[model samples]
Every structure is written in structure tokens, then in C-alpha cells.
Target: MNFDLFWLFRSLPAVILGLTIHELAHAYTAFKLGDMTAKNEGRLTLNPLKHIDPLGFILIVIAGFGWAKPVSFNPEHLKNKHRDEILISLAGPISNFALAFFLLLCARGLFVLPYFHYTATGIEIINLLVSWAVINFGLFFFNLIPIPPLDGSHIYTTFLQKTNPRLFQLVYTYGTWGLLLIILIQVNTKIQILPIMPLIKAITNYCITLLHFT
Candidate 1:
């Protein structure tokens, strides 16, 4: 497949911003939950480099779904360890969804403004906003798959711990391979196993439809 450098360039800013905010949300949530591990490790910042995993970021650029450096937190420091861990793990995706909504609103508002004609600048701004919204939404949903190393796995494991320790152990031990297998299928096939892009489009289209601007 041929790579589109211009498309990559246009999407880079949004990807970086989405990843940064996603990770910062994790770090901040962990800190607020009394686990200062991420904060102490200097992860409580908006710096893109601090959050960007090289391989993951490259995958995002090429494949549309990727991850970032996970924020580490000590469970001992949390009051309700399992529940709190779930909440902390959820913060990243929640932040991305929030950003997606905000960017959607911006795109809609820009389209509705009387002074905002479809000039080069206006078109660029709209494209940027839409790109950012799509990226954020992609991140939000992509991270919600219940697989190891992703935020959703923490929640799944937490709940499983109370219900079935054996099953939890089984999943915990083998989950990484499941995630790797999904990536492998995505990379090797055209079937598009993950529906992240369709979900992003649906949400974005809904937001734009709500605005009734186009």
C-alpha cells in the first residue's frame, strides 16, 4: 500500500494531542486516587513525548489504531484498589471522548458562523477539527477493547477478580496474545476486524447532524 505523506502530516497534530491528553488523564486520575507513582515518574504533564510510545505512535500513523505509554500506579496507595484501578484506567478513554465532543462542537460552530465562509483557512480549520475529533474518538473506542495492556483489560480483570479468580488468572496470563493476534489480523488482512473507524464516523456524523449544519 502506498503511504500518503500529506494525510499523515495533517493527522499528526491531532494524534499527538489526543495521545498526550489521554495519558495525562490517566496520570492525573491516578494521582487524585492517591497513587502518586505516575506523577512521581514525571508523567503528569501535557508533553507529547512523555506519552508517545514509538511503535504505537508509528502504528497509529500507519494503521489508525495505536496506544501510548501506560501510566503506572501503585495499587497499595488507592483506597478501593480494584474499583479505583478501573476508574483510573477509564480516565484515558473518557478524556478522549470528551475531547472528541469538544472538537465536534467547534467544527459545528465554525460551520454555522455567519462570517465563516468556506475559504482556504476555514476549510483547513474544519479539516483539522474533524481530524482531531476522529482521532480522539478512535482512541476512545480502541482503548475500550477488553484485552491486556489496554485500559479495558484492567476493568475486566478487576471485575473478574471478585467473580472468578481462576478465569481472571487465565485471562491475565493469555490476554496479551489475544491483543497481538488482533493486531496481526488487522495488519495482514483486508477484512478490517476492528470497527473503530466506523464508530468514529457514526459519532462524528451524529454530532454534525445534531448541529444541523451539514
Candidate 2:
């Protein structure tokens, strides 16, 4: 597998910022929902070092989809276990989406600046802003796949645990392995077990279009 050095250079900032914010959102939401585990573990910070998983970071930069170190929380401490779990799980993706929208607006704002296009620095900044927005959008959708260790799994598995205990046990036990297998297959071959690029591109384009009218 060949790595693109230029792509990595441009994507590093977005990857770090997006992953940090995503995990921090999880930690903060869990803390707010009465789980102090993440806070006690010193995860309620904006530091990228605390949130980034090395392999995930590399994969995201190269493959456009990956994850951060998951924020741990004690379910026993949560006020409403099931409902709060869903909210905590959702916080990461929601925060990424919000950040993406904000970044898009910032990028749009750059277009109106006088002399912005004439300067190399301004052009690079705008490009970075757009890249950041799209990367965040990718993070937003990627984390929502209902596989284990991802945010979406928690939401669905919470309900599954109640309605189908046996099935839930199977999923909870094997989902991570299944997710890893799918990733490995994609890495080795051309099959897209979880095709998400189209969704990411569609949403990013839609947001850009909306910004154009504003």
C-alpha cells in the first residue's frame, strides 16, 4: 500500500482536530450524564494525544475512515443507563457534524475576503478549511456504522440487549472481530463492505450548496 505524503501533510491537522473533538464530545457527554469515569481517567480535555489511536489516525489519513481511542464510562454511574448510553454514543458524531458545518461556514467566509485569492497563504488556509470540513463530515458518518466499538453500536446494542438478549450477546461478543474482518478484507481487496464515501461526498456537497445560497 502506497502512502500519499502530500495528502498526509494536508490531512494531519484535520485528522487530529476531528478525532480529538469527537472523543472529547463522548467524554463530556458521559460526564454530563452522570458517568465520571471518563473525567476521572483524564479524558475530558481537548488534547489530541489523549484521544488519538495511532493505528486509527494513520488509517483515517490514508483510508478516509477510522476512529479515536474510545472514552470509557461506567454504565452503573449513568442516571438512565439505556437512554444515556444512546446520547453519549451519539455525541461524538453529532459534534463532528456540527464542527463540519461550522468549518464550511468559515471556508465560505474566506471567499469574500479581499486579496484572499491573491496570496498563497490565504489560498492554503481556505484549502485546509475545506479539507477539515470534509474530513469532519467523513468522521460524522463513519462513526455511525452500527458495528462494535463504533458509536452506532452502542445505540442499537442497548436496545438489542433488552429485546434480544441472546442476539445481543452474540453481537457484543463477535461484532468487533466482524468489523476487523471487514476492514481487513477491504484493505486486501477492492470490496467495500461498508461503503460510506458516497454519503460523505453527498453531504459535503449539499452543505457547500447551501452555503452558496447564503
Candidate 3:
């Protein structure tokens, strides 16, 4: 077993930050959309402790993919169930993307400071920022996978419920198991079935280009 302690040290905070922001966005959006369940449950805050799931956090640290505690919302309280549900589901991923971009911008800003690049601390800060940005980007895309219990599933199922009720019911019922199976297979076989890294790298490269970072 080849354990990388340095990777763990760098990724732990990034994972916590990403998960915290992602779940908080969900809770906040639900609150804004007239659902008080998340807020009433004391989840509408930036505190990572409220959002972190122990096993999930551990998995993300070791496996590069995992989940946070989900925000609960009452769809009945929403003004428009379908639209508001989609919006609430979208909030998590959107927040992660926004955070990633902000992190990249922060990194870009750090590059121009006088003699900042000459110090070990500056380089470490920039590396941490970039790592955090990448983790947030991963969270953004990973949550958007259209499987049960993921954010994208709400959007997918909402539309599918109209066109094909039976199919939608089937997916809604068993999609989580399917997702788990896929994950298990990938873990054991080391196959890149999801192909999400390419997208993350593309986005990172695009941000780097736009920010003129070396």
C-alpha cells in the first residue's frame, strides 16, 4: 500500500472547504426558495462541521470523490415545485464552480505581488489555492452526475417524470444502487468509466489561460 501523506495533507482542507460550500449553497437556496427545513435544521451556515459526512469526507480524501451531508428541503414549501427543485439542486454545483473560479482569481492575484513569488510561503499558498480550486471543480462535476441522490438527478428525474413516468420511477428507485455499482467497479478495476478528469483539466487549463497564469 502506497499512502501519500503529503497528498492527504493538501487535500483534506480542500475537500472540507468544497463540501462545506456546496452543501451550504443547497441549504441557502432552499431557504431562499421558501423552504425552511435546511435552515431550521441548522444547516444554513458556512461551517464545514455541519456539512461533512465522516465516511464521505474520508473517501474524498483517499479516493478523490465523495459526498457531503445532503440538505433537506420541503418541496411543498416551494413556490414552484419543479422549477424551484431544479434551482435548489443546481445551487450546489454552481457554488462549487463559483468557488473554483474565485480560487483561481486569487491565485492569479498572488502571482503579481512584489517578491511574493520568491518566498516558500507564497508558493505554498498558491499551490494550496490551486489544489483547492481543482477539488472544488471536481466537486462541481461529480455532483452533476445524473444518478440518484446526486444534484443532477433532480433535474434529470424532473424532466423524465413528465416524458416517461415508468422509466422515471425505475431510475428513481434503483439509480443509487446503479451508481454504487459503477463506483465499485471502477474502484476495483481502475477503469475510467466516468471520464470526469478530462473535463476538470480542461476547465482548469481554460482558467489558467484566461488568468494568464504560468
Query: Against the true structure, what is each candidate's TM-score?
Result: 0.90, 0.90, 0.91
Candidate 3, poorest ten consecutive residues by summed lDDT: 57-66
Q: After superposition, how far is residue 141 of candidate 1 from its true place, in Å?
A: 0.5
Q: Write the per-residue lDDT of candidate 3 for residues 1-214, one digit (tens) a residue.
A: 2357898888788788888989999999999999999999999888888999988877666665678998999888999989999999999999999999999999889988888967999988987899889989988998899898799899878778878999988997799878877776766676878888899999999998999986
lDDT of 3: 0.87
Model 1 sits at a Cα RMSD from the real structure of 2.1
Which is better, 2 or 3, measured by lDDT?
3
Q: Among these predicted structures, which one has the highest TM-score?
A: 3
Query: What order do candidates take by TM-score, descending?
Result: 3, 1, 2
Q: How high a TM-score does candidate 3 get?
A: 0.91
- For 1-214, candidate 2 gives per-residue lDDT tens digits of 4567888888888888888998999999999899899999889999888998888877776765567898998888988989999999999999999999999889889877888856999878877898889888888887899998788898789888889999988997799888878877876778877877788889988999998923
Candidate 1 lDDT over residue span 1-214, tens digit each: 3367988988888889899999999999999989889999899999888899999888777766577888889888999988899999999999999999899788887977776746888878887898888888888988988887788888778878779999988887688777777877876677677787788899888877877756
Q: Show pairs that collide, candidate 3.
A: none
Every candidate's lDDT: 0.85, 0.86, 0.87
Q: Which residues of candidate 3, in runs, are more than 4 Å off?
A: 159-169
Q: How many residue pairs clash in each candidate?
A: 0, 0, 0
Once superposed on the true structure, which residue ranges of model 2 sit more than 4 Å away at CA?
61-64, 118-120, 162-166
Query: What is the Cα-based lDDT of residue 42 in candidate 1?
Result: 91
> What RMSD does model 3 have?
2.0
